[model samples]
Every structure is written in C-alpha cells, then in structure tokens.
Target: MSKVTNLNQFRKQQARVKKREQGSVNAEKFGRSKAEKALQESRATKERRDLDGHQREHDE
Candidate 1:
C-alpha cells in the first residue's frame, strides 16, 4: 500500500521556494545594496566639496 502524504503542504512549500528564488533574481536585476548607495552619495558629496574648495572667493 502507498503511504499517505499531505499534498497541499508539499505544494505550498514548493511555491515558497520558487517565490524566494524569484525575489533574489529580481533583487539582483533591479536593486543596489544600501552600502553601495551610501558610498556613491558620499563620493558625490566629497567631489562637490572639493570643487567648491578650489573656487576663488569673491571680494566685495
């Protein structure tokens, strides 16, 4: 005789794994990490400050 199994639970588990894999794939395709974004912002700010520092001050 064949053993009884809960098919509904198995289907739900498989769906969860598939959704998780899809989420990871979407993240890689569409998103940057917080650290990377923060680093880029800081680099831009530093560049702006350096440019401002190099400018000659206007005299009245």
Candidate 2:
C-alpha cells in the first residue's frame, strides 16, 4: 500500500516536470520582441494613469 502511494507521488512529480519543460519551450518559441515589450509597458502605464485619474475624480 505504501509502495503504491509512493509510485503515485513519483508519477505526479514526473508529470509536473514534463509540464514545466513544455511551458519553457513554448515561452521561448513565442517570446516577445523589444517593440512588443515597449508597447505593453506603454499600455500598462496609460492604464495606471487612467485609473489614478478616475480615483482622484471620485475623491473630489
């Protein structure tokens, strides 16, 4: 019984390792370019500014 439990745990760990390897491969395959990274940062900054403006309006 304990052996079976240990086997199950080992299988689960193996599956998780495979999953992380696949995720890393996929991330490298579709990694962002510099332009894309800059665009994302700009959009995030705009969103934060918009949220701050809205909050200030509500406080007034």
Candidate 3:
C-alpha cells in the first residue's frame, strides 16, 4: 500500500471544496430580499453612529 502521511490535510482540502460548492449553491438559492438588505444597512448605520457618539463623549 502507498503511504498516507497526512489524512488531516486531505480532509481539510475536501472540506474547503465542499464549503465553496455549498456557498455557490446557497448564493443561487435564497439571495437577500430588499427588506433584509435595507434592515442590514440600517443596523450597520446605527452601529457606526453609536460608536461615533461614544468616541465624541470620550474625547470631551
């Protein structure tokens, strides 16, 4: 029989390939809705504003 030095390496490579294939399938299947997109943007904006407010308070 041939040597199998690194089974872990083979498993990792398989996992990476599988993950990429699944990601592509998911991307095609259920993309974001407009409402979800808007909600995400709003949450990001709110987080930034909160951070800025905290920085301003600390600077004073």
Candidate 4:
C-alpha cells in the first residue's frame, strides 16, 4: 500500500521548490558585487576616454 499524501500541501511544496530554483538562476544571472560593478564602470570610462582622445578636431 502507498502512503497517503495531501494534494494541496504537495502542490504548495512544489511551487516553493520551483520558486527557489528560479531565484537561484536569477541570482547567478544578475548578481554582482559593488567592487565588481565599480571596476566595470571604471574600465568603461577609461575606454571611452581613450576613444575620445583619438578623435580629430575639425574646423568649419
């Protein structure tokens, strides 16, 4: 004989597990530390500055 289970409780537990899984996926996708973000920002700024420095001045 199989053990009896409450259907409603089982459904809720399934939903919770799915939600937790989604949360972890999202965390991996979007999680970043402040230092990491700052480093990225600084790199971008330096790249932009370097690019701008290479532009030629034109007089009309």
Please report the candidate that would top TM-score against the real structure: 4
Model 2 over residues 2-60: C-alpha lDDT tens digits? 44458788899999999999999999998898999999999999999999888744454
* Candidate 3 off by > 4 Å: 1-30, 56-60
TM of each candidate vs. truth: 0.54, 0.48, 0.45, 0.69
* Candidate no. 1 TM-score: 0.54
TM-score of 3: 0.45
lDDT of 3 by residue, 1-60 (tens): 988669899999999999999998998898898999999999999999999888744454
* Superposition error at 13 for model 1 (Å): 0.9
Ranking by lDDT: 4, 1, 3, 2
Clashing pairs in 3: none
lDDT of each: 0.97, 0.90, 0.91, 0.99
For model 1, how does the per-residue alpha-carbon lDDT over 1-60 read when each residue is reduced to its tens digit?
998989999999999999999999999998899999999999999999999999999999
Q: Arrange candidates by TM-score, descending.
A: 4, 1, 2, 3
